[model samples]
Target: MAATRLWIAAAHDPAHRNGGWAFVRAGAGGETLGRAGGDRRTTRARMALAGLLAALEDLPPGEALAVVAPRPDALVLHTLLKPPAEPPAADADLRAALAKALGATTPATRTWTLAVGDPAGPTPAAFAAAWADLASDKAKAGGAFVHSIPRPNLAKVQGL
Candidate 1:
């Protein structure tokens, strides 16, 4: 079977040590997934990895997929796709988890694709929703929330 293609995006607030992320499968009628969270201490990179890991965890084991994320993140992820020069450090645990997630999927094949676009352009709809959730979390004095809803239902919930 062919691999499924997904578009993913994330938002982070360094000062708050929190962020949100979202993903949508390519084409119409795919489900939209999103979540927001934070640690007392965390970096942008860690949050991005956390989002990707969450997406992976949500997938069925051995499901072949081609994950795509916006540019700068794609660059960071590409660096991670390489072997570490030295022993793992701060993000080591997350990286290890990412490895395990990939392992449970397709065997021996690359899985992510990064898209290059005008950063000034409007945020991808998925990312915008993520940002809204992040803001909501901040306002509530709590961290994050998760939801998996069909595209149309998600639209209604978001009041879009």
Candidate 2:
């Protein structure tokens, strides 16, 4: 069975509401999905609350809630490698690079820049570590958010 976890992956810009809350059913072996994008008229609170419910509905039959989207306790990972450059010459190459360096399909933080990328250059080690760290943080945020509110309340809570 996959180890479930959750997290809210936000962009560096506060104005951009393109971020989403991630939910991993089980470590590297499980599925990774999330509720992304928000409209100006809708507050993140509502999106999150609704997203939580939507995500829950996908849980496998007879499965117990093992993790929430907003929580204090979560896994922690260090930067291990730099992410592949943006607009990689070839998509296959990018996948191969990430697979070789991080050994994971998806990164906790989407995109190379957010996960691990610098104009100067990001090492493979740094990228890998950053992704690992984000994985734990995202799961905790989702877990904690759910813990505080069993159901979607449309109540905006900080740090989620």
Q: TM-scores across all candidates? A: 0.66, 0.30
Candidate 1, superposed: residue stretches over 4 Å from native: 26-40, 104-110, 116-140, 149-160
lDDT of 2 by residue, 1-160 (tens): 3334444322111353222232322323443443332222222333333333444454443332333322211110112124334522333432344333332454432221112122122332222223323433444344222222212321222212
Model 1, span 1-160: residue lDDT tens: 5665555555666666565555545422354454444443455566567667766776765666665666755655665566557735768888878877777234754354445433344444445345534543563365555555345544543211
Candidate 2, superposed: residue stretches over 4 Å from native: 1-3, 8-22, 27-29, 68-160
Q: Global lDDT of each model?
A: 0.55, 0.31
Tell me the lDDT of candidate 1.
0.55
Give the distance in Å from residue 70's predicted Cα in candidate 1 to where it truly belongs: 2.5
The positional error of residue 137 in candidate 2, measured at the CA in angstroms, is 21
Task: Indicate the residue-level lDDT of 88 in model 1.
Answer: 50
Q: Model 2, 62: alpha-carbon shift in Å? A: 3.5
